[model samples]
Target: MEIAIILISALICMSVVAIKLSDTKLSFPFAMKKQLFTAAERQFLMLIERAVGNEFRVLCRVRLIDLLSLKTDTNKKLANSALLKAGNKHIDFVLCDKNDLTPVMAIDLVYGAGKDGHNVQRDFFVNGALDTASIPHVRIKAKNGYTLAEIRECIETKLIPLRRRQGKIPFVAANDRPEVIKRSTKPTRPLSTSRKAVA
Candidate 1:
């Protein structure tokens, strides 16, 4: 009995050590951080999101990509959907961002000269909604301002109209209350200066 008890305690000690070592080395889901896009790309994205009136909560980070093709095109969507259907391997980036906590902005980025039909279609969908929807749609084409300044200009323009719609003052909506009109219709204040999260 004494020998059996000693062996059991030894086994328990070994098991605890094994678990501790595995915990440190194991590649757990959600262990990796998303890669940051290039400065120019991030600048472009921030501009687009701001133009569309998303305040860009932390959830926005996951959706940021090397390019927006991940969600914008139907083929990719179908492929992803099929993956779910098949119970095949999961895509980490897509899964991480799929919770849809924030609105998804699918910007189809075409880096070079040859035109991509996928990109063209995405742009059409994004821009076409501008005329019909109150929510700002995704912008298409390389606009007059590809520069950071240009991006800022677009966001500011969108904010201007939203402010106008709100009238003089903005009011907070509360439980079972009437839509409170805001007393101040001031536009959103611009950042004092742009800061890059990653260089």
Candidate 2:
């Protein structure tokens, strides 16, 4: 009887341990759901805007665009439309330089929502009309559930590089001599000699 009781107690203790571990695992999703993403996301935008200048604005419009779908004209249109609408919401943080307001940079923070809100980052860019060749709008892929600082740092790294790379067209022409160099000119007679001969 004593042996049986001891075995039963051990089994109960093991079951409790297993249950606790399962509960700890289960609590993560709930914590994620409870996380206040918007506030931190907004803070990140504000930080960038403050650091850069008031000319550029960062827009967080993950809800409007479907990240799972392939890129299409319809998606593009929808994304632009959403940004326009977001502008009305005024959820952006402006970046400014001393000379002028920088062009607004749109960032979409895509999170896997509902059943699919896991391990997905959907981002797109909308070029602002006021944006110039030097300063263009950028799109960034933000990892879901990242802290505010992490998101800001990621955006900075990604966008700074993108802005640097935008207008660069790769050299595609052949290594052969250029057309201008290939044009041969006849030997020119000396100016004095020509004049003397004419005289």
Candidate 3:
């Protein structure tokens, strides 16, 4: 009888331990919701959608962490610094190439009384980072309505120069002397000179 009691006690102990272990496991208390944007943001997104129309893909509220990265050697210090600067922030809209999803430009929407001093400083920092990385960005003030033409013009103004710079290639003349070609592996003219030529 004592042996049977001991076995029963061991079984009860094991059951208790199992219950405690199950309680310790992680539990998710949250549920997924559909609406992700505020009312004002939705209105702005509609404007962006209308502006972009069928030409380019517009992504809303893109995380800065997803966009910016340190492409050089994985120096933890530098990587951490870049992440710290960009981790919490997000761009209002990102225009991308429809085919390959290459980011064409980043747009920030400034609303309500224009950016204050702190916002100005933040903008300067973000602008500096984008410029250093050779990415084009534009800041647009939130207004009642936006015209497609205006948006197109703004994008084209920045994109045209970038496209020109990216498309430029060295030109070699068929009639150029063999000696000149032999002396120079590439064209002597700079890319900026080619830009002028293309223009």
**Model 1 — TM-score against the truth?**
0.31
Give the top-scoring candidate (TM-score): 3
Ranking by lDDT: 3, 2, 1
lDDT of 2 at 76: 75
| Global lDDT scores for all candidate models | 0.45, 0.46, 0.75
Instruction: Using lDDT, give the best candidate's number.
Output: 3
lDDT of 3 by residue, 1-199 (tens): 9999999999999999999888878666788878887565688777777777777799987877787777777699977887898877778889887888877788888766654321433466678778877779888766776677887777777787666666753345676647643476666765465344454
In the predicted model 3, the residue pairs found to clash are none
Cα lDDT of model 1 by residue, 1-199, tens digit: 9999999999999999999999989966676557566444565566655544434322232222221233344597775654454342111111112235433232344444434332433334334332333334333344335755665564445455555665843555587587768687676777785875776
Instruction: Provide the TM-score for each candidate, comma-separated.
Output: 0.31, 0.28, 0.64
Residue 166 error, candidate 2, Å: 14
In model 2, where is the ten-residue run with the lowest total lDDT? Answer: 62-71
Q: Model 3: residues >4 Å from true position, as ranges?
A: 1-25, 31-34, 113-121, 163-199
Q: Which ten residues in a row have the lowest lDDT in candidate 3?
A: 113-122
| lDDT score at residue 70, model 3, on the 0-100 scale | 79
For residue 182, model 2's alpha carbon misses the true position, in angstroms, by 30
Cα lDDT tens digits for candidate 2, 24-65:
988855334564456645655655655554444443443222
lDDT, model 2, position 15? 100
